[model samples]
Target: MSAMAAPREHDGADEHLMELPSMRNPDPPPPPLPAAPPRRGLNFHPAVYVGFWITLSSATILFNKWILSTCEFAFPIFLTTWHLVFATAATQLLARTTDLLDGRHRVKMTGRIYLRAIMPIGLFFSLSLICSNKAYIYLSVAFIQMLKATTPVAVLVASWALSLSTPSLRTLGNVALIVVGVIIASWGEIALDATGVIYQVLGICFEATRLVMVQRLLSANEYKMDPLVSLYYFAPVCALINGAFFLVLEAGQISWVNDVMGKVGLPMLTLNACVAFALNVSVVFLIGRTSSLVLTLCGVLKDILLVVLSILIWQTEVTLLQFIGYSIALAGLVWYKLGPEKVLEHLVLLKQAAMEGRALGVVAVGVVTVLLVGVVWYAFSGPEGGGV
Candidate 1:
């Protein structure tokens, strides 16, 4: 009787222990999250930078065209001078008046550096601006943009020639596609002006040379500058050069009769300058945060939009061949951005598959190839298989 009683007592104690709230299952507390890093300046969504750059660039181009062509301003030199002058004044105001741009780089502002290095670059810059603006007078914005699509070719060639970048056949081949596309576009142009084409080509060359020189000079000096600092340094020199050209070449051409400001009034001109400087700031911000590849893709997208916008706003007539060629050039730009090694690997696999047994890669490649070809055909030829 005693042993049975003891066993019952032990069982009752165990049941009581289980009934206590402390003995029940409970959820574990959540792990703590790490703190976020602080942003340096005004916080913005990443798209802000890209959006501003694209819109500003497009606006500047359109504004310049309207001033020089439609308004019959016919003063490319003076207009360029105004842009540089405004940029210089605005940059100085931001740097000195406001504390916006760090504004405290310690570059050696020697006369030698200014005359030998900066002056030459500014000369090329001035010429490039003048020529591109002049081209706007003769060629439709759509056509001019189509020609500018070959900028990558000029950049790659110049970079390789200057030893700023390594040479690669794959790179060359990719850019060759771009050149081929531009050729096609040129062939199909409705209003091909000799002077316009010459101006465009000269502008491209000058622009490419300026880029290479910048890389070489700045890198050799171990000096890296944000776009603002660059503008601060170069704008004055560019302004002086452009101003001289204006006095020499354009003073007599302007009527000075239309309130001395043409159709785009003084207020509008000031707004344009503000937008242009904002674009410069946007470019600096973007390049600081993103990769070169991202910038290239953004540029390609901007070009495409500019072409379409030209058609919509200016009623620029785009031929089927021009559209097809622009598409091909854009495709090549995409390929170039994919990296040369990866593109070659795919191509080699394609060839090997053709020579040997078909593989999964071949099927994938064939599918993409077919898809691209079909799209091109459908775009160039009408829905009913007739040429446009």
Candidate 2:
């Protein structure tokens, strides 16, 4: 009996040992929640995703400006069409050859879901890009940036109308400040182009609709927040739609040999497309992991940085009124993000600390925020060699 019991015990021990590795994941732990201190550098955090989106988006604008204005490409529709083509190729290649997009559903291009959900989004997307690129022909970068500030307002209102978001009055009021700043900036615009304004507003409406559609199509719990996957699905549809537009509007009139793209600019345009594709990936990531409100805030912050960059790189003229209006807008954006309750909560905490002695959390959070912002600014502000 003792020998039999010993054998059974040993068998149980062997079974337990065999299951040990299977019991736990071997992969690294995921990045923590936003409430936790943010870890930087290509991690799966919302901050990192938003940072990627901002960097690529900023690069896209600067690159497109160079291609259009400096290089005199004279082919906005072709350029956008090429971006979609490149994105589709790159995403498809990655999906086929790598495990990066492995678990993504591997969704096919020809499904009822595709026609009903994605096709409409792609049509609007095509229109938005076309209008956006066309606007650049009429508007200065500074003016465009000013108009772009109204994106948050457009997004929120569209979201509310579509039942995509339920923002509080405080949020609406905060976004209103953005609108006010934008109006002030527009009022200050030196060369007001009515056509450009029309194009921009139309593009904004289409874009706002697209964003809401994205949430409706993809805001599911089971979906993995992989930007690559989203790109794989959306890229082909957008490419086909843009391709049709390009063929109709641009194919006959384009001067292939005289155009910048034909004369040693292919590589440059390809590189620009690569960056644009990366921006799409970052967009999907940010949208998947964060809210539209957060995405709106991210856009506002990026516009601020772009305004500064427009001053530095493009040598765009800036007025005192424009500068002051933008500053007020930035302040409003910050206040809106923090909200009255959060601001009051922080103030109460600080007050209590003044009266008593508990203040570590507030102090720590402030220090961390300051340090992170400093690091990011130093990194992206580029080399500081010359000054005014």
Candidate 3:
């Protein structure tokens, strides 16, 4: 009995010793994770990106207008096809030669996805380009820009239709102001072409639909792509569709080639294509660097500048009523984008500034009031008040 008790005590001691080892020597904590490497490449200023995008975008539009209208190469379908073709080739080349389109590798793109997703979007994109180019042939650049001010309204409506966004009455009301302004501008057009207005309106609708579809695609993480990668997928399909249309509609007009080459020159056409492609690339940089608000403001500024340039370059006739309407449209656009809360916040700040007796704030309020009064007076005055 004494020997048995001694062995049991020894066994207990051995169990205690086993517990000690684990307590004293738990597995070592995981090695510190390797520090992430610093990002490489030149960091450009946001202004640089914004300016580059604006320059390319404005240049592309002006160049296309010059080609289709001034040069009298009136085959919009053919010109649009050429642009898509060049874009397709350029994007493919960039993908092979550089890492700019590396983001595409992450996209879980399959044949089914391309057919169902990309193809439909491409169809609308092609239509929008074709219609917009055709409008330039009939409408002045200033009027087209005025009409385009309603694009956000169209996009918002499309978003609601697609169920991407809930229909808010407040938002709807804000956008309605844009429509009203555009209607007034259209009424004031000195050389309003019904055909051109139809084409531009159709273009806006198609573009809005495309934008909504793109928003849906981008909602999925697997479908996320930068603008360049998006172009790489979209350009090819759009090019093919536009090519089909060109063959059906414009191919019979064989005389266009001689006119285009002789008047515009092959070199100028090539440069136009290059500028259009560059605009896509610039969009990538601009989006990466800037916020949506910046893009919206920049676009508004570009349109205004384009209107002024049209007046100077093509002697485009813009009546006083058109200017008033366009200004209203721009104001509505800003208000919509900024939201009522933001606008109120700014107003509050302005009030504070006025209370503080800031000269700039006082001047701004006075100027705005004077302008509003003047616009009201002129609008009611007579036909002469609204004349060019």
Instruction: Write one digit per residue (lDDT tens) for candidate 1, span 166-265.
Output: 7777567767887888898888887789999999889878776776666556543334444566778788999999899888898877766573465667
Ranking by lDDT: 3, 1, 2
TM-score of 2: 0.71
Estimate, for each residue in 276-313, the C-alpha lDDT of model 2 and write its tens digit: 76665544344435643455445555666666666567
Name the regions of candidate 2 deviating beyond 4 angstroms. 1-53, 106-110, 163-171, 219-225, 260-264, 281-301, 336-338, 343-388
Report lDDT per candidate. 0.63, 0.58, 0.69
Tens digits of per-residue lDDT for model 3 on 1-388? Answer: 0001111111000110000000100011111112112224735787786677667766777788888889888888888888888888988999999877887898899999999999998898888888888999999887888998787787777877777667777778887778888888888899899999999999888877876677667656677565567778988898899999989998888464586678777788789888877766665544435544455556666676677667657867677778778888988876776676876787798899999999988986786567555444443453344355
Name the candidate, 1 or 2, with the larger TM-score value. 1
Residue runs of model 3 more than 4 Å from their true location after superposition: 1-41, 346-388
TM-score of 3: 0.80
User: What TM-score would each prediction reach against the true structure?
Assistant: 0.76, 0.71, 0.80
Model 2: per-residue Cα lDDT at residue 215:
51
Model 1 bad stretches (over 4 Å): 1-41, 103-106, 160-168, 341-388
